[model samples]
Target: ASITERFEPAISWDQVARLREIWKGAMVTKGPLGAQDVVRAVELGCDGVYLSNHGGRQLDQVAHPLDLLVAARRAVGRKTTILLDSGIRCGADVAIALACGADYCLVGRPYLYGLAAAGQAGVEFVIGMIAEELGRTLQLLGLAGVADLKAAGEGVVRYGGSPASRPGDTGDFGVLQ
Candidate 1:
């Protein structure tokens, strides 16, 4: 069959409900860009909601997952798992996601690039690089570990641009050094 003929433009919530009914394993709904959708997925029995913009390849100028993450977390509370992806190119990005409220981050492109360059070894190298960078980022933030990120919450990162008047604003709440 042709791609157009096979592709379904929309998947109804009823379909997701049916899937939840039959699938015993954890069910995660991907590509939710708004808090409402994230909450909706949880209400529909999805084990987790994956926040992504498909690398913005599917649609131009879509909201980045990071932009929506905080609100999603607030809407769903801490109990429902929230997985984040898209524009996550570095360990600091993972830390930022976790600080903002993601329980897990899906790193796709870097590992794929590694695989393409040197198969399994390349993939391992990329993973190691990311982990090392994350450790460095945590250290710089004065955090003891990943759990500290959760404890600090959004305080670990500065949102918007740092205030010019403050000049080295580490003392301020939510301002990163």
Candidate 2:
């Protein structure tokens, strides 16, 4: 049989509920683009919700997970675990995600690229590089560590153009002053 003929594209809420009942391990639902869907997933007994846009590969203009993350976190509160993927290229991205309320961030393509380039060593190198970048970012932000980054919350990130106080300031876009 051809791939399309054998593949089932639809999965209903009932199926998800059933899977939750049968599966004793942690269950996380991926691809939630808004707070409502995040709340719905939690209502359905999901242990976590993974916010992603599939790296913008699935759709032309899907909402970015980072854009939706703050509201999702507000809707779900702090108890339920929230995982974010898509567009996480560096450790600074991870810090931003955590500050915005993701409990954990998932990195895919970078490590995969490393794996393809030079096996385990490449993956290690990429991870180390990311870690070093994150460390530097934290230092620049006057933060001690990841715990401090999470504790700092959204205050650490400033979006869009620079403020009037420092006109023509062309510093980093996301890092707050």
Q: Best candidate, lDDT-wise?
A: 1
lDDT of each: 0.82, 0.81
Q: Per-prediction TM-score, please?
A: 0.86, 0.85
Off by over 4 Å in 1: 159-177
Question: Candidate 1 on 100-122: residue-level lDDT in tens?
Answer: 88999989999999999999999
Worst 10-residue lDDT window for candidate 1 reads 159-168
Q: Write model 2 residue lDDT over 1-177, tens digit each, in one string.
A: 876689777777788889999999999998876899889888989999998888888754987788788888889898789999888898778777887788999898999999999999999999998889888888888999989988888767654322211444455555555
TM-score, cand. 2: 0.85
lDDT measured at residue 164 in model 1 versus the true structure, 0 to 100 = 17
Clashing residue pairs in candidate 2 are none
Worst 10 residues of 2 by lDDT: 159-168
